[model samples]
Target: MKEGRRVYGAEDDDPPGPQPGHEYVELVGGALDGQLLDVTSWAGEDREGGAMLITENGLHGPGGRADYEPRPGTPDKWDWQGDYP
Candidate 1:
């Protein structure tokens, strides 16, 4: 992994992103709707645990966190669970 690279959010300016062996998952619903998630170094459990995405306009409003989980049978998508403080 490159320095300063966060393997959570998929939008990056880094060159040759989504490198070989890495995967990008499309998000559904919530504040980060339609955005892709980076799971390059994630294991099966990591993917299952999902991620708490930080956002200013998440389900709980400004400065809240967006909860997203993997969609069953879909290896390239994450469904929004909700958001919280």
Candidate 2:
């Protein structure tokens, strides 16, 4: 039998893996519910503002991006704002 294709963010552009001082942040909702985000470069308000990460729409190609913002009172995690073109 043949293996099936991944129709998710499994092959998306992830952070440079885990590193010192660069802890991982949880990604809630959307296509990246259990994904982690690296906001090491985001400083102060920038971290609070949010981000629009590019994600090749799995199987669809040029699939747009995955929006995420820091959860209220939860700085260690980001909530998915939704996907966009």
Candidate 3:
């Protein structure tokens, strides 16, 4: 086990959350895949926060796809959007 790594209760090989600054890829639906991500801020009081969620395929607003939407986090928060090729 690596330092600061969070382990899932149900599965030993899985994590309950993602680590900061680490890149991860996961199979979503059909042929599209999502990435696990954590963004960092150096000016913060402590290390940056992290999240585990799917990526958005289409741009928001006019003519956007309807099948995929942002995943909600906790009770009041939500993790959404990304820029990649």
Candidate 4:
């Protein structure tokens, strides 16, 4: 999926991704009561930012053992949050 480039505050030409002064929230996928996640990235960052909703969970993707399941109990372990700005 593609999202429109957004700029917050003084950054009128900021690129897509997480920005220090900017904040973004996206609903990944989950049931009404199930866990929901949001992925975000700053304007000057290559890595994406993520957070868990409904539950204090974590984000995981790629780089894992032979078996990998995108679930709460079977997370792959990733550090989406970073210091930028």
Candidate 5:
């Protein structure tokens, strides 16, 4: 396994919580709704700190609830938005 990478527990194992070196992410708009925002420092679980908001304009960081609204009728999918440098 890679360094700082977190592994999810098996079906019979306990759930892994708040992993170190791991940041939770979520997509806000576009075709990739409810997807993981792979863009580093772009978006994350608010509980972790704050989530970045991405739009047709560009990437915004440390955003709050008032930042952007998610699109309706988008299915929650685990899709990769792409990697960040």
Candidate 6:
């Protein structure tokens, strides 16, 4: 729930919601496949973010997109190629 924390699944316990200047990643699958969301809020069952389409190139969102590769030895860290939007 703290800002900049990476959450793997919905079943996992929600952390503190995102704070100002904080970015949160939610790995969504099953019903929402190939999608990673920027967690804006996690109040109860409500979850929201600026939707990003996960592609071979990278995570694409409105207004901006970046090429990201999974960091070695760190599943939570992504190597962002280009400026992070």
Q: Write the per-residue lDDT of candidate 1 for residues 1-85, one digit (tens) a residue.
A: 3333334444557644445566778778988886667776688788888888888887577779988888888857889898989
lDDT of 6 at 35: 33
Tens digits of per-residue lDDT, candidate 3, 1-85, equal 1344332221466555556465332223321333322323322222123232322444443333323223333311223334223
Candidate order (lDDT): 1, 2, 6, 5, 3, 4
Model 3 alpha-carbon drift over 4 Å, by segment: 1-15, 30-85
lDDT of 2 by residue, 1-85 (tens): 0123222333456433354575457777876666666566667888888777777652224757888888999877789887887
Better of 2 and 4 by lDDT: 2
Error of 5 at 14 (Å): 20
Error of 1 at 59 (Å): 3.4
Clashing residue pairs in candidate 6 (N, C-alpha, C atoms within 3 angstroms): 1-15, 1-16
In angstroms, the error of model 6 at 67 is 1.6
Clashing residue pairs for model 2: 57-63
> By TM-score, how accurate is candidate 6?
0.28
Report how far off residue 58 is in candidate 1 (Å): 1.2
Output candidate 4 Cα RMSD: 13.4
Question: For every model shown, what is its TM-score relative to the native structure?
Answer: 0.72, 0.67, 0.19, 0.18, 0.22, 0.28
Q: After superposition, how far is residue 66 of candidate 4 from its true place, in Å?
A: 21
lDDT for each of the candidates? 0.73, 0.65, 0.32, 0.29, 0.34, 0.39
Best by TM-score: 1
**Which regions of candidate 5 are displaced past 4 Å?**
1-20, 39-85
Identify the candidate with maximal lDDT.
1
Task: Rank candidates, TM-score, best first.
Answer: 1, 2, 6, 5, 3, 4
- Please identify which of the two predictions, 2 or 3, would achieve the higher TM-score against the true structure: 2
lDDT of 5: 0.34
